[model samples]
Target: MPVNLPEIESMELYPVAGVKLGWAQGHIKKANRKDVLVIELCEGASVAGVFTLNRFCAAPVTLCRQHLAGNKGIRALVVNTGCANAGTGEQGMLDAKKTCNAVAELLAIPQDAVLPFSTGVILENLPMDRLLAALPNAVNNLAEDNWKDAAYSIMTTDVAPKAVSEQLNIAGKQVVVTGISKGAGMIHPNMATMLGYLATDAGIEQSLLTEITKEIADLSFNCISVDGDTSTNDSFIIIASGQSEVQFNSREQAGFAELYQSLLASAQKLAQAIVRDGEGATKFMSVNVHGAKTMAEAKAVGFAIGKSPLVKTAFFASDPNLGRILAAIGYAARECDSLNDLDTNLIDLYLGDVLVADKGGLAKSYKEADGQNIMNRAEIDMTVKLNRGDVDVTIWTCDFSYEYVRINADYRS
Candidate 1:
């Protein structure tokens, strides 16, 4: 079960003015599921995207980069679930291009104006026959208030739909931002097995939007880890429709900071939701590392602890095996190039609010029962005071459970 995740029925999401979403039952890999999604943008919307760093990325990821580089002014996005379309050679690229071309023709736009995304079992070819047959159904059903369905349509292994909305007043005009993301496993920094789309009514210059996309990715998508595996079909896109009166040409412009913060808040919520809904996750952990010389060194220690199988499993069994964490931190300082020698004698480790370890060993006042109590909670916080420099970073992760292995063992069955 997902750790401390909210129910979809309790969510109320706002819609961006120029974006309309529609979904269809394409049966890409399963019957009666919403597997095809189309999101159409208005004429003047500006789009920026960040993709996976995996060397063998999916076919649609390749095509999406090419289409965005073409500068034809993107007008629509098409997504399919249950077939990654990776490791299929040249036919995969052709299939991806065909999806873009078909969506463009349906919307009466240039072919290069469309971006495509896919998620699911890797190395298998996408089921184009069912996907193409379902396109008309999705396109004809486009509506402005379908964010919930759009979220569901993109799920592969996710147990819950991740979506969020934020509003802020800019120059007395109301600006709206809405976004959705999906991921459950094969999650790590450098993106994940996920697809995120964020749309706003406030206008942003193309160059600035691109720069902000990378920044937002670093702060949000790049700060989560689950199962320590990165996927080949990750994508995060931001679209500014320029439909509202609040428009900015640069970071220094008025209202840009407010609007950007709203967007960042929305992104952080959506990104954390993925970690909360991690596959077979029973405990959500926030690993915080402070007093580092640089953000990179802080993140290195956080990930080293977050991705360590021994550390994750210890939390799962409600064990206070503190040595595993200290071991991870030691190796992180040695492995990461950004940090010089680290002194554990000056470090302090806390599980929840209780100080457990310090001075290169267990604290005299630390109790095993206190550590066990925090580990048993649905949500836990691990704070590390590196005592090196002054940078602080937070990485979200989840504990591995018996069900985690069960799910992956039978994933293809």
Candidate 2:
């Protein structure tokens, strides 16, 4: 049973003001599918981004970071799904630059304005010629209304393309925020292996666009986890073209808040869609941790519990294994030295209140039926109370199953 979000399907994307959208099916990988996507940014539009924090990040991530940091208005973003352009050392950097150069030449934009992103097997060299050959076709197919096709073109293991759009009212006029993302596995906090492209038709300052992007991504991509593994090449970019006449004043305008909230909502909507389509996931789980000493402690505990293999397996088995849940909490709290006697003993597991575990041991009142019923739901909410402070946070995760292994084992093929 697929959980359908109406907001996703009912999303209305306003045509980008000056940007012409396009994509290509470059045979950069062996998938024989459309392995490349291109989104040509309007000249002088502000660009902001967030990239993976992995120390061994891919060449494209490194290059994109530098390109975004330079802060000059960008003209285009070119992406491929066959090679991550990572772990190839100097040659990889050269290849990334070459890919950008090729895109710049074909689009008649400067190479510096072109950003490159690659996702696929790491350590393998990219098939530059195959990717290059598809550029002319992609350019010729550029259209503002083909975002859905562009979204699908960049997918690898994703069963379906992920995208979302939202309408916001600014100064009594409607503004649009449209976005697309790609990710299936190797997803976790600290920047998962996801690539997202967000476009808005509202007019705003470059610095303000950068601020909104960092803020929204922190609340969206940085808060979700699928497998607890960060990929080498993960990046997200947002482009804002003042195509709409709605001008936002960073200091005086209250409409900016509404617009930013809309953008964050759209980003989170896409992020959850990625989790729903997670490889081998049957149930989407969200853990909310409250009453901790601080938000940091809350997140630490939440991610620890969310990423626990035992908890994930319990979810797969559809068993409310309270012990595994409590154990994960203890270990995670120990890392932060936040556990106290009350914190240790006050914790209780309610297999719907059968008291499956209490005070760090199995409860005699535990029942198998209660556990089974809780796991039956497609959406499971796990709550953890620290009993120490009011600080709290939430995290998203998915159940692990045998199919996950099957998918990853043959992922490269």
Candidate 3:
């Protein structure tokens, strides 16, 4: 069980006005499981996305990019779990296209207007026959309030279905944002191990949608880690259906700022949920790096700490191993070529509220029990002050455990 991660007791996902979703038990990997999802977007909907930086990205990712670039105005999305359709070369590409074709044909939309996504084992071909056969069931079941089912359908190793919804009044019209994401292992920044879908009814230009999607992805999905491995199928997509009467000409528009904030908050919650439910995760950890010379440097430091297996295990053991954190920060500074100008003597570190290290060394009044007490909790906050400049960043992560090793070792079996 994930530590401090609550089971979403009630499905309260609000319906985005111009979006509808459905799922089917394609049995792509497991029997009688909802392994496929279909999202139907109304005409005039604008969409944008950011995908994994991994050169070995999945076939569906390639198709998604190509289709998006064509500017046909995406009207549908097909997602499958069980076979990632990654590392399958040309056949994988063909399989992805076929799936898109099936969805497009079923919905009577142009083939280029469909985007596809997949997750699961790598280097295997998707069960295309079964997947294609399930398309009609998904289309037949489409409904505006199917967000929760869509969330469940996209899971691979996720312990919980992550979903979030928010609504705001824009120019007297109610606009809604609802999103879902899934990830557990093979997770890290540079686009963590996840597939995220966020949709809103507020209207925005397609170009602006593309720009803000990348921006929101940076502030959300790109700021989390689980096992330090960026998956090949990582993707985050945002859509604007324009069902509401409100439209924004620019970021300066009265309601744009509020809508953007709500969107970011929803994305952040979904991202954090992935870390909270990380494979074998027993504690949710937040690493905050402050007073850095640049945001990149701050993020580097936070990831260095967040991705350190030694640091994660120490937290798992409830051990106050402050030295491990210092080592990680030093290594990050060196790796990012910030060490020469980084003044260790000006650094300060805290585990929760206890100052474990000050001026780059042990705090004179620090106590081991104090750090241990904080580490023993299901949630932890680590604060590091570089005292270099004004930039800051926070990265979410989880503690490693024996179960994590076991889960991955037996993953293919």
Candidate 4:
């Protein structure tokens, strides 16, 4: 069960004009499950993405970088859940390329025009035989409105598929922004904690998209954590298909700002959904760090609290242990260079609407029962005002429980 996460019902997901999606039950990890997906883009679609910063990234991640670096237009994306093609050395790369070649062959496109992604169970070779056998059916099944099924296909531990869709007018033309993401465990972002894909009907110049992709990632994918472990196969991709009349090639264009913000909002929703559905999560926690000298400092303080096991477990048990949180902030200040001069005496901590700590220590008017009342809720907001400068950032995370350990301990079985 996911913590306070709503189960998405049969909902509308608008399809981007030039993007089509298909899925197949490849049984990459388990039988009778939709474990494989393909997203085929029309010719001239512009695509850009950011991947894990981990040095030992998966084979498909390495291949994706090589393909994207060529600047040859990407035509399609293939994804499989289960048996991450990582730590298998040369064989892994071969298997990844073979998966691309399979998709390319089916689509009558160059192998270099395909990007591949995989997730689940690190350090194992991909089951290529089943993957190859599934590609033809996946390609044959491609359709413009299959976004919902596509979301389900790429899931691993996710309790429900994560998807967001929006329709907005840009320069008198209608633009559609829709995206999906999957992650439940092994979550932390050097780049992003899981796999995400976003597409829009409004086109932008490749160079500009390449620049803003990182920006979109920073504000969305980079601001979340689940279990504090960064995955080797993490990736976030954004695509723009020039099928609508709202196409633009530069940031200076008339409607780019509106389109960009819509994309950002969609991306943020998808990212937050992952934390809400975090593996064995019992509480959805928002750590807001304000009045920081820099964004880097704010993020450091937020993650320090978000990833703290003591803080997370205490939240799960509905305990407002203010000491655990204060300790985390003290250590974050010590670790962040920008916060070297951080003054604890100027800090204030709030749990939801109640002021628990004021000016570095417990607020005189605060009571234990008041703190407990806030903690007992399934969602919590912990605001820390560093009073150092004016920057702010929010980190989304979840509380750990007994089910968290149980889920991971038997993950392989």
Top lDDT hit: 3
Model 3 TM-score is 0.98
TM-score of each: 0.98, 0.92, 0.98, 0.98
Question: Model 4, stretches more than 4 Å misplaced?
Answer: 9-11
Candidate 3 achieves a global lDDT of 0.91
Q: What is the C-alpha RMSD of each candidate to the true structure, in Å?
A: 1.2, 2.6, 1.0, 1.1
Judged by TM-score relative to the true structure, which candidate is superior, 2 or 3? 3
Question: Against the hidden true structure, what lDDT does model 2 obtain?
Answer: 0.79
Tens digits of lDDT, candidate 1, 1-413: 67777766324778789999999999999999999999999998999999999999999999999989987799999999999998888999999989988898899999899999999898999888999999999999898889999999999888889888877898899998999999989999788678999999999989999999999988988899998899999999999999988888999988888988988888888888899988888989999998999988998999999989999999989898988999899889665886557888988999999998877789999999998889889899999999889899899999999888987888777
**Runs with alpha carbons beyond 4 Å of true place in candidate 3:** 9-11
Full-model lDDT for every candidate? 0.90, 0.79, 0.91, 0.90
lDDT comparison, 1 vs 3, better candidate: 3
Query: What TM-score does candidate 4 reach?
Result: 0.98
Q: Count the backbone clashes (under 3 Å) in each candidate.
A: 0, 1, 0, 0
Q: Residues 303-387, candidate 3, lDDT per residue (tens digit)?
A: 9999999999999999888899999988896557765578889999999999989898899999998988998999999999999
* Local distance difference test, candidate 4: 0.90
Error of 2 at 171 (Å): 1.9
lDDT of 4 by residue, 363-384 (tens): 9989989999999999899999
